[model samples]
Target: MFEWPWKDIARECELYLGPAGFSAVQVSPPHEHIVWEKHPWWERYQVASYKIESRSGNEAEFADMVKRCRRAGVDIYADAVINHMTGIPGGTAVGGTSFTHYDYPGIYDFNDFHHCGRNGNDDIVNYKDLYELQNCELVDLADLATETSKVQNTIAAYLNHLLDLGVAGFRIDAAKHIPAKDLKAIMSQLKRSAYVYQEVIYDPAGPISYADYTPIGDVTAYDYAHRLGAAIKDKKMDGLLHIGENFPASNDSIVFVTNHDLERTGDPYILKYSSEDQKLYRLAQIFMLAWPFGYPQVYTGYDFTNYDDGPPLNEQLRTLPVLSSQNQCTAPFTCEHRLPEVAAMVDFRNQTDGSFVVNNFWSNNTDQLAFSRGQKGFVAINFSGNQLPKEFQTGLPAGKYCNIVGASYNPNTHSCPNMIEVNAQGKANVVIQAYSAMVLLNRTTASQKKKAL
Candidate 1:
């Protein structure tokens, strides 16, 4: 969700996301931006000014949302757009502020932007050239002259202002366009330490590399999403066994199955929230959460027929609320994260956080894959259409554990209706349904719920 609607959604974080064990919520960009007629989602990325006001609501609403969500044990990560200003020649922003391609009222002047002398026009044409890609305008947007001290300070000030509002971190939007040293300089000027992740889309053959930005902060693991999506689609479990091979070190990467951009790319390798691939998408997310990987972020947003279509809007053109009826997500709002299975996997991730090493890995040489988190947790995934019934080495203690994918343990009653009993020999006879997963965690409420009779 975007615009003022996210405020109401943030209020519901306490009631829903907090108990679900989500660590943070990455809200849409809070900065003022250009006002498009149809209100395309990309408009939010084309910033007008650094002021904490936009279609997403005024500064007061943003502040209140931060405070409320923080109190619920969920940190707020703002999507900071610092690489450029409005792509439009002239327009009034959602904040009622006026701006042109090279100027934003009191903030940036024509001199503050880069009119990079590139191929014919100033726009980026050669992605293989690092210099042009860094200096040239992206999609006609006025690129920021970040090499200058004044520009670095300006960017830092915007981030510092967000930190002052109790914002826990930032998703550095379009970070690949900005030079790594410039980003390091800007990040160094922050008044306080903040969690930072740069969006450096991985391109193996590209001149710019994600490794260049990892020294400053975690970089988005695009390769993970790309490879995992392909593996799932092809039903090749072996490809994912060493998924992080060429990617950044696990600690320096922020991984996800899909994000706002990749989901809209219409790329076959990238999975999106849709009726056709819903089951497979959820299964992939379950595998990502269960497997030890980079900090995994789950994406949940609205459905769109057209790539440029924005979130559902009101008569005022502001975004409409992502409401629910009878505990089911309403139209236009997919709310994929709130799905029972995805929510259960969140708990699976939470319970097995520190157990990073993948132990006792097993597969049927194909679609059926199973692994354990050093005895802390175990998972079995069946991507094939046929049911997977097998006696395998579970690597868990003898106990009756809840199959969290289907049903969760009721700690209050110390019972789990859907239980799988592991024998004393650290083995179990289990069956996993087609295109589904089964997760069991040791040293958890489910493990202690009851003993195997």
Candidate 2:
């Protein structure tokens, strides 16, 4: 699913992302980053300038993509890498911009960066001290003195330019590295209310806290990921009934199963699609999409055994065109967005929006879960290794509804490849197999099913 040149991603917004009911596409850092050998993915994180020209495309091309995607009813969430500059000593960046470590021309100079110690060379070796986490270089990457007004203005300008280009929001990368005061100042200066999601890996033992950043924007729910990962990995579907139990409430979280950083690089917290726990990974996505929780994000990228493997590309290192056919997957790219279950859940989520979960059904076995999002929809997921057969009170009027999960829905015919019937009493006998999900939608009436579909 690797599509470079902002133009290609825009096209995907229409074909794949938009059609799949996704509201936005979280893109890589558009800024000019340190170009590395073989075009590793992290090179984009090591930014030299805020110019929108890197492996993806140039400024004009990026602007055009933004316009096109907006027309397609999909928004763009750009990864803002403002925490630090290239970890490696800089040269001319991918966009032909000249730079040196801690000294970006016309942008940042030696005084702009920080050092944990007075020497301006200390790496982050401790998390106990708040200053060390906020002021020190993260993983040897040159840290920015974001508290300074000069730095705040520069970052604001960079972000505002993206706003002018019609970007919906930003995912502040490595936000924990910058102090909360500095982040507040930078966000306050932005002219528009761009949707902000900060990347602060929550830690109870760490000096910085997630609560301080939640006032600014949604914080990445790593705690949710860890709990969900454990539940799925241990086959404890019962544990997932209260998935968002301790999270920062439903409104203040960007819940996801796994992200680019967690799936790759050092300190992976979950098994990726390439590993033996692939089924659990996929199942986790299903639960996230179905359950009425925080805004859900479905991650689909190139599959790799190695952590440093970049996007799928041709001989020129230019990314290959994203294709629709599964057969076209040259590399091990796990395009989970295209899965039938995932797509159907998107429909389920929309139909059940603003509806709360009720009529829960689970027992001691707890391998099976059945719940309704008010009367609008009903869903049952069976995560046990064996097939399950059970009857539950669906809480819907007598009608025939299509099972969107195990089968496809035909809006034109108002028919389902497979259908389920709820009797007059709102009781339905549901049979689900291992690692499978079933959905019955009430809003999808015979006449309006097309709209829901």
Candidate 3:
């Protein structure tokens, strides 16, 4: 969640994240990388060596974190930038490894990289050219020759190192640039089968198709965020009640509202947890979590006023620790997952596992929507202004239900700090505020005294 080292994250696993019901934590790239003057986050994406040494922490610390999170029942998903090498010609890595472009000491040699610059070509100008896009350099990063046995061995060995360290999976950076067959080949050689998600940016008209990658692992549904955010931004939520409506299959997709890339790459349709859009962004998150769509990933990172700005750092280039504000998240960090409602929603998902949306209802104006996941849970969302007072089929057993979004379920009291009563007819007279949502969990009587305070 927070942009901190593995050690810092380990300390909070049991106390903060584990209790919140997080399945995994996707960390920044841990490979040794070309160190820049300011140590930008993208620089971590540029590889120097497979050594588990970088700005985040050393080998021992990384190992300790994996062990700690496992005990807490949270897996670590390391961001593996195996697509290319550093864009620079020569530089020293943050871990003290020294190397130049396409030449890492004791690893790859010059021939291991693709010299795609035919006419001194250094950039990708033809988005329509399939061969150029796959074989050529992306933003000048030296493309690896993954088809060769030597390159495949080195890549697999690197990932095996992480698997040996207890990493649960990998987020293959720039996965679209690598052929699916080559990727599958590398993964097949891992020490053990590991969960894998490829960073394949979706472009429907682009040469690369997600079909090639889904057989391997989940593909990033960038289109999900782009399209969903657009719908919510335009105050249209009725059409999105159906999960996987405009996205890849539920099991093959990984959905998110914003990530490191989208926050900086300004697109009006996409969203960031900004002052004006924070509420709306949270609504999108609710929809994602409530709906039975692809695996959902909630992003919580550094707050940046400038698109190029990296996480808060000291003069020594070390990341500053993030603190909680007792509200939704801490300052300078969009800790959306830490919000009481969001955390409760994580539990909401777990309680209603194997459930599908039923008893679906959409308002006449289409701005208000309600649905049930099986008979265990119900959710109502109001996207328009003013209070919305309407009765809808909840599909849940009748009781004094707690609004997980607005209140907390106090187990000791066996009552909600804030309660919304539902009748035996499976109806709730829900009145949600503008751009707000309510979630009801019948598995247990939710109460605000336990969490909503």
Relative to the true structure, how large is the alpha-carbon lDDT of every model? 0.80, 0.76, 0.77
Let me know the TM-score candidate 3 reaches against the reference structure.
Answer: 0.93
The model with the greatest TM-score is: 1
Candidate 1 least-lDDT 10 residues: 444-453
Candidate 3: residue pairs that collide: 408-447, 408-448, 409-446, 409-447, 409-448, 410-447, 416-447, 417-448
**If the candidates were sorted by their lDDT against the true structure, best first, what order would they fall in?**
1, 3, 2
Per-residue lDDT tens digits for candidate 3, residues 155-214, read 999999999999999999999888889998998899888889989886778888888899
Task: Name the top lDDT candidate.
Answer: 1
Off by over 4 Å in 3: 323-331, 364-366, 408-414, 444-453
Q: Which stretches of candidate 2 lie over 4 Å from their true place?
A: 1-5, 118-121, 265-271, 313-317, 324-332, 363-366, 411-414, 444-453
Ranked by TM-score from best down, the candidates are 1, 3, 2
Write model 1 residue lDDT over 18-123, tens digit each, in one string.
Answer: 7777888888898888888788989889888888876667888889888988888788888899999888889888778887888776788989989889877799
lDDT of 1 at 431: 82
TM-score of candidate 2 on Cα atoms, chains taken together: 0.92
Selected candidate, larger TM-score, 2 vs 3: 3
